[model samples]
Structures are given as structure tokens and as C-alpha cells.
Target: MESSSPPADTNRASTAEGLRFAFGTLTVLPVRVARWDRAAARTGMVCAPLVGLVVGLVAAAVGAVLLWCGASPLLAAVAAVAVPAVLTRGLHLDGLADVADGLGSGRPAEEALRVMKQSDIGPFGVITLVFTLLGQVAAVAALYGQGWAWGAVGAVASAVVARGALTLASREGVPAARPEGLGAAVAETVPFGAALGVAGCCVAVPAAGSAAVAGSAGQVVGAAAGAVLGLCAAEVLLRRCVRRFGGVTGDVFGAVAEVAACGTLVVLAVL
Candidate 1:
């Protein structure tokens, strides 16, 4: 009789391939993805939070080192904010700027998307970028002033939460804005259960850590509150995107992630 065991090696190879795709697409990380099919793309988006986890940790590490070296909180915060921008090649920031320009134009779906696709930044883009960056810097600085640990915590939490928003956007029934491009490639590829499971883990891990040091109940509640608010911010943006553009695009995905990060940081800083 022959053994009926599953192909463990094949499964492992597939997972590794998926991870490479995720990091390659989501970050400036030097990873080569060998596959580009629907399954691979779905796996990549599902695994996006893993990239966020690494990015957040690196960002926090930079801020912590600077603070230890006697840098001011503001400077450290700026460095922290700049690290993600550098790591992702400012892709998310660019998306945020483009989406801002498009929405601010008050044009119809096609016109708005066309405006967003333009290479040049508009006045609305510039204004949105300035305020958003300033808000992130200020929030991180506030956390840093409280303590380096707090800053680090907030950094990690926000990054993970932001990517969680992307996971949300990737779920089934979330239509793509265009029939081509990144949106079309990965749109509605993620199963609702997968998105929910990843999102819950992303939201819960940080909250659990907070509970460990600062007592269970209050810390958990605070983290939950922040996560809820962050998700809400992303949801509102998603709704508006659907209304204005007919569905989420690659740029809209990035915009949701950035907005969720900002919302998470603001909530953490306040609470």
C-alpha cells in the first residue's frame, strides 16, 4: 500500500513563493517573486501584514536608536515617519497624494481616475501631504515624549493596522476600479475569512502586548478602540472610493492603508 501523505515540500515552496511576491510588491525589500498568477497575487495580499510587521519593527528600531543617542523626540519622530516612506519608495504616500488630488477635483469617476493617474502633483495633493505628514510626526513625537517604548508601540501598531486596511480592501466583493492594472490583478482575490483572520491577528497582537505590561482590561480596551477607529477610517474611505470611482484601485488601497495608519496613531497618542 502507498502512503497518502500530502506534499509538504510543495506546500512549503508555494508559501515561500507567496511571501516573495508579497514583499516584492509591497516593499523595497530585495526579494524576487517567481509567480504572477491569481493564486500568487492573492497570497501576496494576504501576507501583506507580514511586510508591515517587518517595516514597523524597523521603523521603531530606528526611532529607538535615535532617542537613545539623545535625539529630540521631534527629530526621532521625523526619522520614524521617513523610514517607511523610504522603505516603500514613498509609494503609499504617492497614492495618498494622488487620491487626494482626485477626490478634491470633484470630477466624475473616469475623470477623477484620469486626474489621479497624472504624474504631477496638484495643489490638493500638496496640501494633503503636508497636513498628513505633520499629523504623523506630531503624533509620534507625542508618544516619544511619553517614552521611547510608547513611540515604538504606536509605530508598530499603526503600521500593522494600516496594512490590515489593505487586507480589508482585498476581500471578496471589493471590486476593482479598472479592468487592468494592480487593482484588476488582485481585486477580490482574498477570501473574507482570510482577511478577517489576518486583520484580527494584526489588531490583537499589539493589544495583547499592551495588556501584558499595563494590566489586561484597560490596555486591551484602548487597543481595541484604536483598532476600531482605524478600521472605521479605512471603511469610510473605501465607501467614498466606491462612490466616486466605482471601486477600489491600487492607489485607493494605498490611500486606505495610510489613512488607517494615521488614524491608529492619533488614537493611540490620545488614549
Candidate 2:
């Protein structure tokens, strides 16, 4: 009798298809390449926050482990940053560059976006990338020096909360510049719950810590303030992009994540 199981080639193809679907549905990778259909894109948009949660936890766990291993606060912070950077293979950074290049060109929105879609890097892109990276490094370093655990919390919280901001932006924004792309799919399909879940996770981190010495009222305030500010900033950016570019692009989303993360860290530091 013939085996009921699928042939090896068929099984491999099935596995590959599943992997592709997961990647396209769970993160910004589909946004980058513009592979998602309307429904898939929406599903991906909703999954973005959950992706951030996973990323945040990974970052936090790494930072916590480094701290436990007697690593300096700075080193631990760096390790935390490194985890997500590696996981996403700097895709967000690329988006940042594209946005910077487009914004700096001083061209019309359509032309700027055209430039952004190309693989070339302009002077503005280079400078913006440097400044953004430096700012993040310094901010992380400063927070770590003052309080490693709090710093870890800020890092993780920022990562997750930023995704929430992104989701909100996608939901409220216009369509893509072109007829179709990740932006369009995201706008059409991203669920509201994904953003809520991301925000919840960020809030829960500090709330859960309310029992520990490190989880004082001040820390709670700081986390809450950071999240609020991040969300607000993201909304402003989203509105501006919708008006200027006619919709949110993958680059805009990247910019939103970076801005939100930075804003959250600043609030945490101030608080």
C-alpha cells in the first residue's frame, strides 16, 4: 500500500510555505518587500505588536542575564540592544535611512519616496543614521548607569510600546504612495487588539514590579509617562506622514519605531 504521508518534496514545500506565511504575517519583513496581500498585510500589522513583545522579552531576558552575570550596566544595555538588532537584521535601521534620505532631499513627496525606494544612501541618510544610533547608545548607557534594572525595563518597554505606536499609526493613516504595498495592506488589515496588547505588555512590566524595591512609585510613574509620550509622538508623526506622503510607508513606520523608542527612554530618564 502507498504511504499515506506526504512525499518528502511535498512536506518540504509545505514547511516552506508555512514559514513564509508566518514571516509575512508576524513582522515588518513583508512591509519591506511588499509581499503581503490585503488580508495578509492586515494580519501582519496586528501581529507586529506581538512580535515586539517577544522581542522585548528577549531583550529584557538578555539584559537581566548579563546583569546577573556581573556585567557592567553599560554592557548589559548594549547586549539588550544587540538582541533585537540582530533578530531584525537591522531592517528598521534601513527604513530609518530611507526616511532620512527622502526627508533631507527637499524634493516633493513623490520624488522623495522614489528616492527612498532605491538602494542608495545619501548624506542625510548617513548623518541621520549616525545621530540616531548614537542617541540610543548614550541614552541606554546613561539609564543603565543610574539603574540597570530600570534601564532594562525601559529598553524592553520601549521596544514593545514602539510597536504599539506603529500599529496605531497604520490603522489611522492613509494608503501607500503607490497602488499597493505593505502600507496599504497594513492600513486595511491591522487589528486594533494588536496595538492594545503591545501597550498592555509595556504597562504590565512596571505594574508587575510594583512589589519589588526597584518598583517604586517613581518607577511606575516613569514607565507610564514614557509610554504616554511615546504614543503621542507616534500619533503626531503618523498624522504628518498621512498628510505629506498621502499615507504611511515602511520607512515612516521605521521612523515611528525609532522616535517612539527614543521618546519613551527620555521620559523614563526624566521621571
Candidate 3:
């Protein structure tokens, strides 16, 4: 029998090593982490979207299968949208809800963080989840109307772009809300260049791929623009999160990913 990979608690670092940590920590899939040190976490966050690449591909496959079965666009869209949430155990959506609850509470920073920590969802959280999920469903459904091929492109791109936002959230100057936890471990570990490179690579993938599939430079440009806009939207929310909660946290990363993804889908449909 083959030996197992190292346990998740070990400390190590490298892009290759980071891939294990990223998949293990971010997804329900059982990719073993090489180690869990700060180096691993930083690289893990940097390589975060690599996990999304697989996620997007899987989501595209799910949508494609539903369409192949003669399902309506809306039905196919719902399944496609649900795939990532199911895979990630709804981690990003939960963060968006927590952030909504925290900011909407209109309390002080410490109080807001406390509100987010609670196990129960608040009214703000509930409302945000409803609208955000609705927006994703609506947008993907619209894209599917164009064709399942188009829908597949949008689904995969949106997944990657959403995960890309987490890298931006970790840039230098972003503070951690507390002395310990995920925030403290990953915050500032990804420099601006690393974040920019990751974002550029992610946006480029769909743009280049779309051009090949749809055979239009305009479509490629539009997809690229939508991805950038999605990242910008996430940045706006990140600013609010910082001002509201005193800094970034694991929850903040999750919130940014979800919102960015939704925004990307909306733009993809319209553009």
C-alpha cells in the first residue's frame, strides 16, 4: 500500500504544496494538505483560484449535463449554481451572510464581529442570502438562454473570478480583526503583485477561451471587462468590511468571493 500525504497540521510552503492546502481547506473534496503553517496558508490563498478552476469545470459539466437532458435553462442554471455551493459546503455564502449581519447591525466594530460569530443567521444575513443567490440564479439562467455552451463559459469564469477576489482581500495594509485566526494568518501574506498576477491570469483564461468558443473578440473583451468589474465590486465591499469590522477575517474572504462571483455572473449575462 502507498503511504499517505502529510497531515494538515504540518508547516510548509511552496506553490505546489499550497495547492494541497488550498483544496483541502477550501473544498469538501479530500485533497490532503502538506502542512498548515503561515507559509502554507499564504501560498494557499495565492493558489486559491486553482481550486476554483476545478470547481468551475465541474459546475460547467453539471450545467452541460442538465442541458443535454433537455432541461429548461432555469432548471439547468439552478443546478449549475448549486454545484459550487455544495462543493465548498456553502462556505462563501455563509460568509456573505455573516458580513451582512455584521454590517447591518449598525453596532460598534467589536460588537459587529461578535454578531458575525454567532451560529444563528440574522435578518440581514437572511435577506442578503436571498438576494445574492437569486441574482446568481437569474444571471446564469439568462446566460443559459443564449446556449449551454455560453452558460458553461460564464459558470466557469464566474467561479474562478470569485475565488480571485480573496487574493485581493489579503493584500498588504489589510488588517486582521483579531490577533489570531485565519485573518491573522493570511492577511498581508499575498503582496499586490501576486494578487494582480493571479487576477490577470484568471480573467485571461475565460477571455481567451471565450474567443475560441464564441468566435468573437467582442465577447472576449466583454467577459474580461465583466471579470474586472466583478473584482472591483468585491473591492468596494472589502472597504466597507474593513471600516465596519476593523479589518479582514476568514468571513470577509468568503463574503468577497461570493459577492464577486455574483457580480461577475450579472455582468456576463448583460455584456
Candidate 4:
């Protein structure tokens, strides 16, 4: 977002650092992050969707291979849904559960944050995890039932949108709830315009590709609409987190990603 032209070498180095930061922080990948400052975080947040693309492709590949092996749609869907979780080491899912418990605790902000930091999941957390996982699996299964391509497109689109939501969440003015940890390290690193531009590009490519594959105008419209609605859902949760928890945390980021991904899958399945 900084418009001042820097040296080409510096630009290349920064981009490499950012990519390493994005992959290292967001996934269980072996990439080592060489920098943790705002400059790297800014680029990393912009590159978050790229990480999602890889994750989605892996998930799609697993499902496609399972289907080719004569596995049932339900089983393939389960594998697809499980792939991202495994790749991320279940961090996003755990965050989703923690956020659910925090929000549902009926405690004050400080107390709720403490509740979320506990080692064990509360009842609300357990319930939220169960429903979210079930919803994702069922929706993917429905798409797989339609056809392998449809399911693959849905999986990839949902993942890309999910990570794109993280980019949006990192935009300027979104404060970190605490002074330390991941949320603090990356919060407000991305510029608002940059975030939107990245999100628009990420959403458009998949939507257009889905349409091209399906050979239907409706598919493009549906995919775009689904992405928009999913982002809106995540934004609502983000606002709530800011209001209730004081601002965003690492858990909030994870919760936002999973919610956006699940919402996108549901919309894709229906439309």
C-alpha cells in the first residue's frame, strides 16, 4: 500500500519475506518466517489468499482422488473438509471453538477472554465445533453429489474466500485486542484499499473459472454472490468481536476464516 517506489531488490526481498510469513504462520508448512514486523505482515496479509489457494488445491486434489477411487460422495466430502484442518494443524477450528465459547460465556470482556484462553473447551465451544464441522461436511457432500468438478470448485472457492477474509480483517483500523501474540503482531498491517483490491481479484478469478467450467452464467453469479455473502457474514462477526472482546485476536481471525468458508460452501451448495 505504500506508494513510494523502493529499489527492486528491496521489493523482491520484502515479497519473499512476506510469503514466508504468510505460509509459516497460517499453515503447518515448513517455511521459516525471516521477519515479523509490520512491513512483512502487510505483504503477508496480502499474500494470505495465495496460501488458501494451495490449501484448497490440496483439499480438492484429495477429494478428486478419493472420488476417482470410487469412494462415496460423503466420504470424499469428509476428506476434503478434513484436509484443510489437517494442513493447518486444526488451529482455525480450535480458534472457532474458543471464540464461540468466549462469545457465549455471558461474561465481561476480560473474563471472556480468559475463558477462551483455557485449555479445555466449554460446552458452547463443543457445540459450535460439532455444528460447524457437520455443516461443512454436509455442504461439500451435496456439491460432490452434483459432480466432482462442482465439489472441487466449491472447495477451492471457499478456501480462497476464507483466507481473503483474513486479508480484510488485517486492514487498517482493525485494532488488536491485546499487546502480544499473533493478533498484535499482524493487526492493522494491511491498507484498506489494498485489502479490497486483493479480495476482489481473489473472488473474481474463481468465480469466472467456475463459470467457464460449468458453462453457465448462473454459476459465475452464484459464486460471486456466495463469496460476497460469506465475507459479509465474517465482517459481522468481526465487528461483534471488536465490540465484545475490545478488538481482534488470533482466535477471532481463525473463527472468521472458518465461518466465511462454511458460509460460502452452504451458499454454493444451495445455488
Q: lDDT for each of the candidates? A: 0.83, 0.65, 0.85, 0.87
RMSD to the true structure for each prediction, in A, is 7.0, 9.1, 6.1, 4.6
Query: How would you encode candidate 3's per-residue C-alpha lDDT over 47-82 as one tens digit per residue?
Result: 988888899889989998999999999998999999
Query: Which candidate leads the pack in TM-score?
Result: 4
After superposing candidate 1 on the true structure, give the runs of residues whose Cα lies further than 4 Å from its correct spot. Answer: 1-13, 212-216
Off by over 4 Å in 3: 1-12
Give residue 90's lDDT in candidate 1 (0 to 100): 93
Q: What tens digits encode model 2's per-residue C-alpha lDDT throughout 27-63?
A: 4455333333444444455545666767777887888
State candidate 1's TM-score. 0.92
Q: What ranking of all candidate models by lDDT puts the best one first?
A: 4, 3, 1, 2
Can you list the residue pairs that collide in candidate 3?
Answer: none
Which structure among the candidates has the greatest lDDT? 4
Error of 4 at 64 (Å): 0.3
Q: Candidate 4 on 176-253: residue-level lDDT in tens?
A: 887777887778888899999988976785687578676478878888888888888899999999899888888999
- lDDT of model 1, residue 160: 85
**Which prediction has more favorable TM-score, 3 or 4?**
4
Which 10 residues in a row give candidate 1 its minimum summed lDDT? Answer: 1-10
What's the C-alpha lDDT at position 133 in model 4? 92
